[model samples]
Target: MFYRIPSLGGLSPFVSLLSLALLAHNIDAASSGVINYGGDVPIGSKLVQVHVIYRHGDRNPKSPYPKSHYHDLKSWPGGWGELTDTGILQQIKLGILLKALYGPQNYGLLPEEFNVKIYKSVTTDVDRTIMSLIANQAGLWRSLKGKGIHEPDVQWNPTPFRVIADNKYDTIFGQNCSKAEKLVDMFRDERFEQLKNENLQLFQYAQENSGYEIMTHPTQICWLYDTLTVELLRKGIIPEWANALYPEPLESFLMEYLKAGSLTEEMRRLTGGPLLKTIITAMKNLTMGKDTIKMYAYSAHETSIYDVLAALCSPPKKPPGYTATLLFELFQYQNSFFLRILYRPGPDQTAFPMKIPGCGEQYICSLKKFEEITQHVLPKDLVAECTV
Candidate 1:
């Protein structure tokens, strides 16, 4: 839906996906201290906190396949797989929109002045994710900083983003489930065997054009799809032979493989449960006012979104796109707290409210109800749970 414009450096960025409806929006300021954002909010309730999880903006493909058209570095400004100038603009616009939708002068949801003590940001130590946090902060505050922070020439604020040094075994990402991995492995192997025979012709076609020495694994073909997709997103460099297979049988096959593990209760618990537990803990912290943070923004990957969604019993309908986001908000009404969730379908769209399954038909769920519904997937001991 979008293409990159390198010459503008994002000021007049190419009509990319992130700019569609977002750039033209002029959100009306809030009359009171509540942020409605087109959602039906109980009149007396006030937003207490928001927890955000978002994928990094558009970037070049990570894998460099054999005889690939995008092998040239000129096409990738920041080198392969790194966030591009286009992506930076996407994130900047996102921050601007977020501030407009939440800042005190606009929606009156967050504080007027920047308060470090009341906000927190974190990211995996990946280069793209870290850069996204910085770029997003630039838009969210627009050079507004603390009392003593300053720069000699640039109008900039230094926002501290804590980075997780190593997430290889982080339960919050649902990465430590050995049993779940084996189950998913078995499922994919079986599916792959059936698919291999069914799509022998496609396999032959990909083998000839995909550059992989072997087209045996489903993930390998998905990698080809990813490459072409990024190329199409950036410079439209995909060869005709490659384009023929993309976004079709390729995408359908990829989804089946990717979703195989998350289909079952035991799989979702061990594979996606840990992240849900982490979010539930944050909700509890806000309920107790234990942490002063009014918002916590996490710059992460698509898998993080999947973990939260699948564990919440709201598995995604498609691969989460670039800059796709999930927001978990807590509200206070008459001394009781409630939870509301929203999902942005794409970078250019406003997030629609989500009706979490088992939370009934309403968008808002009592904190107690929210906890009760998510309890099954929230593993008390991820390690022991993974032993299954």
Candidate 2:
């Protein structure tokens, strides 16, 4: 007998294992969860557009410890902060699945299987994100070239795409938040400008390691940097930046800042100012693009996801995964255009209860345009186990 426990952040190894086993068991099309293309989905409805976001897949997390804590990559099996062999396989499998779902025949393309307007992107942080995209692209490129369908393809195409985010999402947010808060606190301590000398190392670290260029724009300096300083002043955490009321607890402050849900009002006050402007522009672009575009894809991070969602005025919740793409598919009915949202965890894999607003049905597969077919094919047993 199998038992279930509350999954850690909705993903548990036991659940993953059980779901895979159940999925394998119900691969036959006749099964309940099996997707029989002709029967379930209406034949005439075709997919016209698509958008996706996903995590970079499994990789070693950056910084397993606080500044005061000491540990090294050698402590782990594969050395510090690197993708495992299994992570490589995960990307490869994702590519193969993408090819199967959006093959030449499905997309009605000419050059090959992946001969569509596909824009690929990655972060320059480490080899993991780049390699994962490379492996995934390999499957698509090979499938399009008709090279090694049954076996692996060694050939590669020379194509470059947009890949951003050199700094990990958490790292960027954490550093910026900490610095902002610390700066504000220093101002209130009456130490004014003295705290800058005290935490010189932190400022240097932020410059060297934070992966963002220090802005010289006076507004940004105050908006992004000094606003944080101002918040610190309000908190009375620091003594006016020149003199220290107490020793700057940089290590302790940074440690607490990096953890999930650690972003507080102070951090939000600083970060939110810039994001509000960005969100407005993004929303405007989407609205204008909606007139002609059917699907939109944003190759962004969890912070981006949170930004967009919060822009839409969503409640505070975690955005999962690196490649987690948010899809906004506009459904055109007789006289109205309704927006349908899809959240993809990976290639052709989605969470349960996918419903397109106008479709009137859940788990609809025929409308493959902007849909992850993997979910419709997942058996009930698999779904049950997956939810564990």
Candidate 3:
């Protein structure tokens, strides 16, 4: 017999163990409890454009604890925080997926030849994300080549990606937002304190098992869990103390804490404003027949995805895994445009249609209704709100 549990934060309607088991068996299986937007567009429908924002693929842990036993940087060929070969392959696969979905035969959204004006991509200055963009492009255009190019060994062409300057108020990373920091601090003290108190035993257990000191703060817990997760993924080593700690509860709490810390309505407006503005502007331009770019892609981080989800009022149950992707598809049907949102947890997984709250049974949301629902959440003046 299978049981269902309501997910926290209305992220998902239900969580089923059978679904999870199937997911484990085949990561590409359709996700359980997700509302699919159907595989093919209606007969009269045409895909007008697409905008995708995705997290970078797997990499070594960002930093190691000072007193931890996992201190050998040389052990990781990519060194600390660098993208690995595995990461590159994962992104390549994603690129192939995109090609299949948007390439000439599918939606005819992207041209065969590389055109700066036709397809545009941007990434943060960070190495992993920048490299991910390149890798993704390699996969995206693997089958297509430059005009009159006969180089036997050349299977790929250069694709341009703009690098956002790493300034204090950078939108992609949501860094150096004093307002966001203050908001997070206040929420931690007021709203999260009780949750922490209730989970004291779980936290204590983690502290005892984890080599690094585990703190009650959600961010700290998230960091610790991330570290543990990386270790398990890279090396088949689960810490000895993990056996007694009941790690699943700790993991669930960490996810809950992360959602609370970052997904708050106030936080979304402040941190996710620029991205929302970008998306909305693109969609509006498309509706007005003024949008030149056919496809837009942003290579970003988990925080970016989380904030975007929150702004849309459909926060995920937990953090997005490596190579997690959120796609915004605009379709033209009988002179009207509709939007479809899709989320894939990882590269090997099938994307699930995300139901925009209040959109009702039909997953397709009309442009006007989409704008009305999201208007309040998009930032009016990003700079002023992010000002220290």
Highest lDDT against the true fold, candidate: 1
lDDT for each candidate structure: 0.72, 0.36, 0.69
What are the models' TM-scores? 0.85, 0.43, 0.83
Collision pairs in model 1: none
lDDT of 1 by residue, 264-377 (tens): 777777766776677778878878878778778888887778767877777778888888888888889898989888887557655777877897767889888988988887
Which prediction has more favorable lDDT, 1 or 3?
Answer: 1
lDDT of 2 by residue, 43-87 (tens): 343444444444455555343322211234553345444554445
Which lDDT tens digits does candidate 3 get at residues 141-189? 5533345333543445567789987665576455667787778677655
Comparing 1 with 2 on lDDT, the higher-scoring candidate is 1
- Give the CA lDDT, 0 to 100, for residue 279 in model 1: 74
Clashes of 2: 39
Q: Score candidate 2 by lDDT.
A: 0.36
Instruction: Please state the error at residue 280 of candidate 1 in Å.
Output: 1.5
Q: Which stretches of candidate 2 lie over 4 Å from their true place?
A: 1-46, 66-70, 75-79, 104-112, 115-127, 144-158, 165-300, 313-325, 330-338, 345-349, 352-388
